[model samples]
Target: MALLITKRCINCDMCEPECPNQAISMGDEIYQIDADRCTECVGHYDTPTCQQVCPIDNTIIIDPQHIEAREALWEKFVVMHHPV
Candidate 1:
């Protein structure tokens, strides 16, 4: 599933640079994750790099509205990083 950065984000600038998919960016108030580009780091790391790097607990959580299976996430990764 894609991840969501909650309002609890402190804008520490930890997650934005860690996302391999470049899905994380500065939003109006905090960092935001683009569901269309997010793959939970499926093809890049065992766990999402943004989640791992985020110091605030539970600041980054799965998007209930954009849930996706591992295979789907992988496909997104492939298409994003290895487009033909």
Candidate 2:
């Protein structure tokens, strides 16, 4: 599943640089995750890098609207990084 930056985000600017998929970007008020590019770091890390780097607990959570299984996420990752 993709991740969502909640209102609790402090805009610390930590997550944007840590996202291996480059999915996080500055939004109007906080960082936003591009669901199409977000694979929860499946191809890069064991856990979501944004979640790991976020200072505020629960600031980054699963995107309920873009819910996806692990296999789906892996496929997305492969398509994005492998591109073969």
Candidate 3:
């Protein structure tokens, strides 16, 4: 599933550069994730780069309705301009 960024983001810009998909971006007040571009770091790394760099725990989670198979997620990211 795609990951979602909560309002707890501190706008530190820490997570943005860590995102392999370039899915995370600076929002008006917090960071936002573009689901279409997010791959949860499926292929590029062993874990989600954004989550690892996130200072706020639990800020990123699987989108219940957008559950995606790991392989499919990797494929999607591979097709995009993102790294994952």
Candidate 4:
């Protein structure tokens, strides 16, 4: 699933750089994750890099509305980084 940065984010600037897909960015008030570019680190790591490094608890959580299967996440990863 794509990740969502909650309002609890402290803007520590940790999650943005850790995102393998470049999915995290500064929003109007907090960090935001781009659903289209997020692959949950499927092609790059065993876990989501942003979530792993996030200092604030519950700051990064799965977007329930944008949930995806492992296969779908893998496909997204390939299409994003290995586009034709």
Candidate 5:
């Protein structure tokens, strides 16, 4: 599933650079996660780098509206990183 940055984000700016897909960006008030570009770092790493680096707990959560299976995420990763 794609991840969403909640209001709990402290705007620390730590998670943005950790995203291998460059899915995280500055929002109006805080950081936001781009579901289209987000694959939870599946192809890049075992765990989500943004989540791992975010200091605020619960700031990053799965986007229920954009829920996806593991395989779907992996497919997205491959398509994004290895487009033909």
Candidate 6:
């Protein structure tokens, strides 16, 4: 499943670079994760990078939208931001 960055994000910029898929971004008042692009480090890392880097516990909620499988996630990612 993908990860969701909640309001607890301190804008520390730590989790932003930790995301392997580059899904995390600085939002208007907090950090946001691109659900479609977020693989939860499935095809990349051993664990979720954002969750690992985020100092604030529970701030980054994994599977918040409940896309548990990687195949489904890849499809969504491809469709969301593809080179057309």
Instruction: Pick the lDDT winner.
Output: 1
Clashes of 4: 0
Model 1, CA-based lDDT: 0.95
Q: Taking the tens digit of each residue's C-alpha lDDT, what string does model 2 give over 1-84?
A: 899999999999999999989999999888899999999999888889889989899999999999999999999988988897
- Which candidate do you rate higher for TM-score, 1 or 2? 1
Candidate with the larger lDDT of 2 and 3: 2
For candidate 2, the C-alpha RMSD (Å) to the true structure equals 0.7
How big is the positional error of residue 74 in model 3, measured in Å on the Cα after superposition?
A: 1.5
Instruction: Please give the CA lDDT of all the candidate structures.
Output: 0.95, 0.93, 0.83, 0.93, 0.94, 0.78
- The ten-residue window of minimal lDDT in model 5 covers 50-59
TM-scores, in order shown? 0.98, 0.96, 0.85, 0.96, 0.97, 0.78
Candidate whose TM-score is highest: 1
lDDT of 5 by residue, 1-84 (tens): 999999998899899988999999998999999999999999999999998999989889999999999999999999999999
- Please give the lDDT score at residue 75 for candidate 5: 97
Clashing pairs in 2: none
How far out, in Å, is residue 63 in model 1? 0.5
Q: Against the correct fold, how does model 4 do in TM-score? A: 0.96
Tens-digit lDDT string for candidate 1 (1-84): 899999999999999989988999999999999999999999889989998899999999999999999999999999999999
Q: For candidate 4, what is the lDDT? A: 0.93
- State the lDDT of candidate 6 residue by residue for 1-84, as single tens digits: 878888878888999887767888888899888876887776566778788888889998875556667778666656655745
Model 3, runs deviating above 4 Å: 81-84
Q: Alpha-carbon error at 70 in model 1, in Å?
A: 0.4
Which segments of model 4 are wrong by more than 4 Å?
Answer: none
What does candidate 4's lDDT look like per residue over 14-49, in tens digits?
Answer: 989988899998999998999999999999999999
